[model samples]
Target chain A: MAETRQWRLASRPTGEPTRENFDLVTVDRPEPGPGEVLVKTLYQSVDPYMRGRMRDEESYAEPWDVGDPMQAGIVGEVVQSEADDFDEGDVVTGNLLWAEHAVADADELRPVNPELGPVSTALGVLGMPGITGYFGMLDVADPSPGETVVVSAAAGAVGSVAGQIARLSGARVVGTAGSEEKIDWLTDELGFDAAINYKETDDLEAAVAEACPDGVDAYFDNVGGPITDAVWPLLNVDARVAVCGQISLYNETEVPTGPRKLSKLIESRARVEGFLVGDYQSRWGEALESLSEFIQQDDLHYRENVVDGFENAPDAFLGLFEGENIGKQLVKVAERGE
Target chain B: MAETRQWRLASRPTGEPTRENFDLVTVDRPEPGPGEVLVKTLYQSVDPYMRGRMRDEESYAEPWDVGDPMQAGIVGEVVQSEADDFDEGDVVTGNLLWAEHAVADADELRPVNPELGPVSTALGVLGMPGITGYFGMLDVADPSPGETVVVSAAAGAVGSVAGQIARLSGARVVGTAGSEEKIDWLTDELGFDAAINYKETDDLEAAVAEACPDGVDAYFDNVGGPITDAVWPLLNVDARVAVCGQISLYNETEVPTGPRKLSKLIESRARVEGFLVGDYQSRWGEALESLSEFIQQDDLHYRENVVDGFENAPDAFLGLFEGENIGKQLVKVAERGE
Candidate 1:
């Protein structure tokens, strides 16, 4: 029997989930049953959306049950396989949990090869965030050549890829980040035409107007709040808005409110739509393929801040709200195929 | 020279416009020059959007200059014509003003035949309001047969036509109104499957949920604010929202702020689009033809609250915010010219 530690949801958090909200307990691991594979967790992705799952409220994904291990996107290596689909030492990435090991059905995980770059890449660029960025802007924003596409949270995992992809499609890309460092990275490294550090800016509306002189043709919104309000008036006629996430308001004790900008949508003849990645489950293959190509060609660049322990997962998760991570935030639980 | 009473923008209002905001004065009407016609205003449509134009602030249309005649959609008769396109005694509809008479370019006015029902129908059903209802729903909501469609301000001009159009397309229509009388009119006269007086309901979310058990497939939003917040969660997957107007928040001294719900958009795969009739400029012929057919066949019904006398126009316009009008609010300054 092997020892494993599982992080369970202790209680729903009022605001940000503290260490008290999660309980770490060690338990003996059982042998894999028929049609299942036991995977040793390697890398776990921490995202802004995971904060939403901490609440017992209804959302796109089911709420995490109290006393159960918190689920997350993880890359791991199979240690033992009772199913013929996966063998020992096979690398896999899927929605598992923040744990040392997970026993999942053979059909639950997809095999990943680190030869593509790094095992953690499967959790970021070639993973959920990558697919989210690829499909959303292409399928929803659908920017025409020479059109201006603006994205908020630009230096983050999804926004970074979205801006680059839009640029590749011949659209001018403008992005907004929280800090000057992130803005520089977005403009110089991620291929964004321009970037604005929203934190330092006094007038968001003026900043956006200056960055996008022609007005925003398409907007990929990730951090919705006053920033979104600023972007509202700048949207051109027939503009498309892909509402990815509202990380800015996710951890509030109450609903974070802003000016009702629904009227702006009508004034601009614009469209604002919210979409979950799960909605594109059938079309994920197409997204993955295009993203993989873009990555292979170096057209899209992804950065991951690796915190070296499973115990540090909570910090990494909390850092997402503070805008600490440069791109994708991930936690390496243990060595793979050990 | 003929005498004309013109209504001009006296001042911008902080919230709702008052009688003092409009200045009506009689002046000598200029003769129709080449390619222009002298129109005798019979009916001037009072819309919620005209309030937005009174301010010098930037909007879809340029703001009305101080002391300039406040423009609105009007149905008038050509008492004199100087262009080859129009002739004397021609009944026309144009984006005109609240005046007894005015000179306009022939190209700016469209001939309205009384054969298409009463000429006033040109101002309500066969004009901008009708086209707004038709295109806003068809292009944005795209409701499927047997799907549940909900609309706000359902007894008003746009909402009434939108609900009826959705019903004719095989959608079960649910509507929300501000008063009990409006609710009755919506359910009985407009053929809505269900109607709720939002003013009477303490819990809008629960009320909307009960009325739309399968969830709303399409939402024609005329009044956005707290009512929209209530309807947001009840939207089914891939629900379409056509944001026509946000009348509830329009008169606010400051922007009505609330929790940013950009994240909720992803949960429902919902789309909220703002649109103007100008976007459908090229498609007006198609919409007008279809709406005309619906009216001719008696498949669509519209009611108008016509206020008599040009001097009472300011009062009638101001009555919109008080919910005094039954349907389309119009000021009848003179009889329709045959």
Candidate 2:
């Protein structure tokens, strides 16, 4: 019998998620059923949206029930397979969890080949987050050549990939980040046209105007708050806004006050929209293929903030709110057996 | 020489407009130029947008210069014509002012025949405000047959007409107004599916949900603020928002805050857009013709709040902010000569 640990939802959070909200319990791993594979967990992703799922409230995704195991994107190696597709020693990735081992139907698990890049990349750039950035940026915003595209949280996993893909598509890309170092990475390393350090800037609207002189043609919004309020007025006529996340406002008990200038969107004749990545599931392959080509061409760059040990998973997840993690947040629970 | 009395901009107000913001001055009427006609002003229109014009700040239309005559849509008779398009005793309407008499270029005015409908209809359902509602609701939002459409200020000029047109196009029409009386008028008289009195409702979101059982498919937004915040979450997938005005926040010095949940827009895949009537100038004839046909078929209804004097124009204009006017605000400054 194999050993496994499961992180279960202990309690619903009121504001910021706490350690008390989750519990780790070790148990004997179950044998795989027919047409299923038992995966030995190698890496688990810690995402901001996991905070939303921990709450007993309605969201774009189903909320985690109290006393149920907390779920997230995970990469693992197939140890035992009763499935025709997945074989022993095959690496796989899926929406598994913070578990040492998990059993899922073969159809739900995607085989991960190291030849595609690093195995952890399956849970980061070449996975759901990468596909989200690629498809949402291209399909929702639909930027034209030379059009200015501004993204928020630019150094984060989704925004970084989104900006690079936008640049590859011939857009003039700008971004906003929480720290100066992230700003440097966005502008100097990631090839963003301009990167605004939102923490240092007193006036976000002025910074946006300076970066996008002709006005932003497309806005890939990840952090919706004062930053979005500032960008709303500066959008050109017919500009498209893709609302992927509102990380900054997620923890706030009250909505922030500013210009209430939603009417300005009418004046600019701009379209503000929201989207979920799951809606594009059928077309995800196109995103993966394009993102892979970009990565191979040296056109896209990604950073992984890999935390060691299952106990430190909470730290990595909490680091997202403080902007401590430079890229995708992940936890390596155990070494993979080749 | 003919006697003429003009209402001019006396001063710009800090917040709410006052009687002191306007000056009624009597001036000696001048002769018409080569292509001009001497018009004896009869019916002068007062609209919410005119309040914006009184300020010395820029808006969609240029601000009224300090001490200059206040301009608005006026119905008059051509007392004298120096151009072939107009003759003596012809009824005309154009951007005139709260004056007993004036001189205008023949090219700037449109001839209105009483055979079409009451001349007051021009300012209500057949003029700028009407055509504004027409083009905005039809061309911009494009509410299809059997779709659910909601309009704010349902008993007011633009909104009242917009709802009927939406109904004529086979939409389930819901509306919001300031009072129960107005709400009754919208639902009982105008044939709207439902109406919500925003002032009486504590939970606007719940009220809107009850009124619009199915999510809102199209929104003709004349009032922006809490009403907009309520409507945001109820928007269906592929929902269209035609931002006509933000009457609720127009007088506000700051932006109102609720829940900054714009990210929800992405989850619903809705589009919130802003627009100006002038931007659709090329489609004016089509809208005007269709609106005229609707009125001719008795498929549309409109109301007008006619203030008696040119001297009272400032009061009538300021009343818009207080939600005092029932429908189109117009000033019958002079008796018709025809």
Task: Score candidate 1 by TM-score against the native.
Answer: 0.96
Candidate number of the best DockQ: 1
DockQ score for candidate 1 = 0.81
DockQ of each: 0.81, 0.60
Each model's backbone clash number: 9, 7
Name the 10 consecutive residues with the lowest summed lDDT in model 2 chain A.
A252-261
Considering every candidate listed, which one attains the maximal TM-score? 1
Q: How close to the true structure is residue A306 of candidate 2, measured as C-alpha lDDT?
A: 91
* Local error of candidate 1 at residue A326 (angstroms): 1.3
List the RMSD of every prediction in angstroms.
1.8, 2.4
Query: lDDT tens digits, residues B232-329, model 2?
Result: 78888878888888888666554555556476676677777788877876786787798888777778877889999877887888888888888788
DockQ class, candidate 1: high
The lDDT of model 2 is 0.85
TM-score on alpha carbons, each prediction: 0.96, 0.94
